[model samples]
Target: MASLLSLSTVVSHRILSLHPPPLNRSLLFVKPKLPFSRTVSRDLRMRLHSQTTNYGDKEHKPSSIDSKLNPLEGAGTKNLEKVVATILILAQVWSPLPLFGLDSAYISPAEAVLYSPDTKVPRSGELALRRAIPANPNMKTIQACHSTRLFTFWIPQRKPYGTMESNVKKALKVAIDDKDSILASIPADLRDKGSELYASLVDGKGGLQALIESIRYQDPDKVSIRLASSLDTVAEMELLQASGLSFLLPQQYLNYPRLAGRGTVEITIEKADGSTFQAESGGDQRKSATIQVVIDGYSAPLTAGNFAKLVTSGAYDGAKLNTVNQAVITEDGSGKVESVSVPLEVMPSGQFEPLYRTPLSVQDGELPVLPLSVYGAVAMAHSENSEEYSSPYQFFFYLYDKRNSGLGGLSFDEGQFSVFGYTTAGRDILGQIKTGDIIKSAKLIEGQDRLILPAQNNSSST
Candidate 1:
């Protein structure tokens, strides 16, 4: 076996920096000694996460989006809309291009109606949708920002979830309104190459994994694909910029596994009384709401499977809105997180979580059953002994409403909690969720028969 000293050196090198040398080159010097070398893959998946107290935006000089990304450099294409559509589709499964995270799930009705794209944004304060556009018109950010609106032209009209389609249209319209940033944070080279790569997702070319590979392919530093998932600090961002990193690390706030989904599931949440009431100051009118989930059997199968089974079996029925953590802006905080005697529907989720979770520095690479950033996103609770994803029962509703999160929408529980569903219909009902309220029932009304439920753990639920 290679000396412990050798392994320590490699760990040290990667921990300090988000980017690591290519795998083959990294292991080149380590002579094989024993089967123990297999441990290298497991150990190397450990990612170093970084956070900033400076929730402030950087002072960026206004420049052409094309100048910064330069996507059109080698592309001989003359059509602007097609070029933009291709790049807009190459998304980080978890990468929040500023808009993807704050869709209807995150937006409020009043704000959604009154909100307009803001051209003037603070230079050094935490960046906002308003500031995503640059002061200069010809800047790359401006073009790339507004370019997302044209995606409707390229994206197949059919989407798995109607809500996703609606959210995409709403987000794009807003992005176009302010010359906003879509998948604009990536480099021009990747953006330029993304159209072809993005199209490959449908033609059986590749899915999220392909886009991730493409991002690494554009890296001049030869950063490892797995390491590419780490969160880059400002200092690390500067380091990547200095080393010519592929994507703008600072702006990649929402980072998770980059995988697509098979289809959608509509989870109908029936109020205890099956009745509605008006609020004192005019609130949600929808008595019952459907928590729509894109049964992402592709990304986190175990998590998704467990959730599907529970919904189909009516396991979550009568689950009360036990707890509420205001700081996280979540409803129904799982009350009394019981021990994980819950059958374990084992999956490769944690094993490959580094490829998904961002802003989270844990070694486990498992992705949540669903993204927690969206509103009405239903997620399982966290446990003390097991990993953040050992969810069997219990869930919550995330409520983040805004075009721009500003300082109000920081979710500390994103990678830590498992979100398996999204709110589609009756979003207004979310306002009525309160402590002591009961989840009369949770039924998979749309895709009940289609869901892949997790098998009961025969031998300890493996």
Candidate 2:
């Protein structure tokens, strides 16, 4: 026991002497491996024996040896205590700094959103649809830089400012400052109208200038109302400048019916009860009313083309309307007239062409060019036998209600169907139509020249 005690005293002294005070604590605590420990113990035993032998030779007495070892043990204990106290002081000083000084390390909401991988997630149906449209390279660049387009698209998705006035003023300033770029977006024939709208936006009586005036008055409600009016004008200017159907259809799918540009479809509705239809906008009541849907072929050429062709063929002349939850569906028209099924078509955002026979995964952040979340969205129904194709004769007008939508204001069926068009005019009439209402007539009012039939391509080639 005396030898063991003395050996520990000698080892501690050697550790303190070889490694300075600062490193002694670390060297002492590090658990040596089995072989290293055995070697170290053997070397320490030899050194201890040599020192003990020298002391014995000089003193020639056990009492002298005990006196010397006792002092060495005391010194080793004092050095260990000092090392432990230094470690404890460091722990106490640095631990509190993390709890007190790291508040600034947390990221802000804007920073979090900016760095998010899913930043392309759209907040509005219109914005989603617009982003999905595959256009000419020049047109896409112009659309991205257009002030009115940015203002209209950004307002719905931007982070909230303290006041709506700030949001409106910021968006308006962006739009007003880019007048030259905005004018360039307009078609050559529409530049005169575009210039007039620009003039109206800057200084007209009820334009965005009026919004600025309302903001100056410090009336939030007036600012809100005028902001809506100004945005409406901005939206009109954007529509006038949009380039339609600028990309070419894939060569393999060229044989299928395709509308190369935009088309206008007008449907006349009549009540089943033979009652006069309620007129919108204070117009006189009539037995029949007309609603116009502007069908886009750019994003959904095959689906929109099929729909336009059916309208031109008088397939829906006497079809019955059936009302389902949040939708107004047309009869299948299978027994009355033959219909050709088209592959399911959806153009994903940032993609060049529509993916045929595929449905977008909305949960995975895939959004369609024509979102079905709009109140008057028009989409083809799924084929009776297969979900991979659309029921050529049956279509529906979606009655989108935000109360029924999921996150980002998208409908439950946002990217599932082939949304060919929207009920641009007479959207109010959609809600009034009953289950037994008749589609008295459906006509393609415009864009026949833009229809590229399979035979027309063959004839041109020959």
Candidate 3:
């Protein structure tokens, strides 16, 4: 069977599936007998993603993923690894990236396990015992029992009883403090449980959850805001900064993580120089408008606070309202569609979860308080280039209620952008506004203390 299976025969030719290996050499993709035997080649794994379009439901069903392959000799083992190659072959033919209704499009193998949470412990006949995970992951009170067979494809090798306990603890501390201090801290006792410690850290409370918490949760404290209602539509938005907007084309700017925690503020938008107006009032006379925005300080502290601080500090002054496509109000620099042009933010310690600022959204059993589903909804403008919609100081105003216009509750900007504040007053001003208008003044009249001023952003995209 091993002799019969070749790349040409496996792919181009319709060879029968399920090539079981020799009875003794029957293997799992899990820990092979030799260390040199990697489950998947780096190139093939990347190709798997490069060629993959859809992820969820594209992978073979667990029941269908039978690990049967021909046992190979020396050179064959080195060249055509049967397990990953077979998977790649099947992946190329059937192209299964979608496994268990999940389309995890990253390089991390932990994604599937994190999303697929099954706490059921295996019985004596089963593969391994069950360990209970934390319900509210941040809650420090997690029941600590070690389970071996949960989301893994193959049973992990048991380390010698106490060989690497201290090493794992040190590694975990490094992974936690270095990569993510945001995760709830673990107690010392939990560190003693072999690789289970590492498993728990990444299983549910790691980078994967940061990306997908379809069920959102609200903070204990809540801040409700009221904004004026009226609108327009444009695709480009502005990222207001402390210096206001200097030139539409800033060479580079500092990048930071989103402001988190909760607070309040009043955002005021004023006119700027070189401003032209075609007021909603029948193209009447020169119109001067002051827009006041009240943001719920308690919700989405990082995003809301960042905006509020910029307003209070007068960084948004002189910013241009550059784009008004139909009804969307986008404040791009120089009337062009572009962000501040800062490179991708990379943490010094090599964390990839958040490359830039973004709003907390649909996850942990909750919904967003501010969504651009209605007229006068204010949200941060983000780049459409990357999977992340979080941008520096870009935000815009939706001129009309998209939901009433027949988009259901989902606005074109709803899930992607972060809605932090609204036009609490001066809705009529929004009507009079046109592109190329300068923000004469953007001030924060209240709730200065509520804003969490991030430690001057030390991270850079350079």
Candidate 4:
């Protein structure tokens, strides 16, 4: 046994010296004493030769090299043969262990922004409408300036309940189990109002009270009606909350007219046929009918400001109304002011300020702070030449019908237009209005203090 071990060591050294360079340096030396076979198979010899040819010398062809090395196949050399054969077999199937860490494949910012799961472009009707409008080169710099975070303009303090009136509506939607928690969460400043609201909701016999009773009675139909009516209180409360606008108007837009806060525009309409609208039981039989719109500067300052300025200038006075499928648009060029058109302004939900000239991608989960889904929503008509700008004078009252709208009860043009206000009063009067109805007079009754006009152009054309 001692003699055999010594002979095997010498044969291993001889084999290592004969192969000057092996595929792997560690594979060149056989340290372990393995049993050996007198005759090595052709298959094993061919595999070792193949490995050498692939990893080492590309020019070395597979031939009878094992026969020339057969001189070592003498007494006690079986151990060396077994060691080389075992090492070669293991090397053929060996692989490096996999690594694990926090590292992952990288994605560029620009590419990430463009990436989306939606296969189609402009998935919603509003998005498609906005994209159908031609892109203006002049707006490139302005869009970049507004979207970038470099300038860091001061965003207005968010109201405790919410910035936009819509936020107040969402805050009110709560399960019965969460009623106490919601009531407790009201801000200190609004505590009194919140308490009054809570009392009215629980005991006033209105939609909220009815909703709770319906749930207790387990009536699905009544619950549905009460829930809808309860949610609708948001529109009524919006007008009463005539609180100041919660967002800051950028100084860059000061050159143009802007309303930094809420304003009320009262428009009196009369039939072109000179007929009086039916009056309520206690109201006077006036020939002209009146409607009030509460313009929101928080969501759309520029658009609301421009409309308010035009109202003060009497641009809409005596303007003829043209009825379309789902909207009542003012006739173009009727008291049309030749002022610079305001860019398409839409304040996205969860955003600090309005996005100028760009419309929200509603299908991509972006919605406006002032949604167009409500009935009697007021918005500016798109410019005849470019959809990127709102027409300076002409505007419309959207007659929203849930049946005619897209999924989720959103208006077809939900995010396409600049919705600055809603018809707070006389929503029923909208259905009574006919084509060719005349806006007998238009006036800015409130929010004159919030209107900001340039010194040189104070006539209120825009």
Better of 3 and 4 by lDDT: 4
TM agreement with the true structure for every prediction: 0.37, 0.59, 0.36, 0.50
lDDT of 1 at 359: 27
1-462 per-residue lDDT for model 1 (tens digits)? 334333333322222222222223122112222100111232322110111111122221212223332223334432443343333323311233444444344434433321222211111111211112122232233223223322222245442233323433343344345322322433465554433332332122222233234333443222222122221111121121121212221232122111122235554444555566444458665555554544443334344555665556656566555322221121322333221213222222223222322224222222222334455555454332344234335445556433222121223233444444455555556666654456666655554443433233321211
Q: Which pairs of residues collide in model 4? A: none
- What tens digits encode model 4's per-residue C-alpha lDDT throughout 1-462? 334334334433332223212232222111112111111221111110000011231222222433444545655656756665445323322422211210112222322222221222223222222222111222222122222211121222322212222221323343234555544544567657755655554455454556546555655456456544543332223222334544566666777788876778899999887776876555665567889988877678889888888888877778887664456767665336545578789987657688988977654567776767667878887765456777776688877665544323454356778888888778778877887889999999999999988775433323
Clashing pairs in 2: none
Summarize candidate 2's per-residue lDDT along 183-262 as a digit string, tens digits: 88789999999898777766776465676677567555665565555545555576566556656766766866788667
Candidate 4: stretches off by over 4 Å: 1-245, 279-286, 334-338, 457-462
Candidate 3, residues 179-233: lDDT per residue as tens digits?
3222233333432342343343434332122211211221111100000000000
Q: Cα deviation of 107 in candidate 2 (Å)?
A: 17
Top candidate when judged by lDDT against the true structure: 2
Worst 10 residues of 3 by lDDT: 226-235
Alpha-carbon local distance difference test for all models: 0.34, 0.60, 0.34, 0.54
Q: What is the C-alpha RMSD of each candidate to the true structure, in Å?
A: 23.3, 26.1, 21.1, 28.1
Better of 1 and 2 by lDDT: 2
For candidate 3, the per-residue lDDT at 66 reads 22
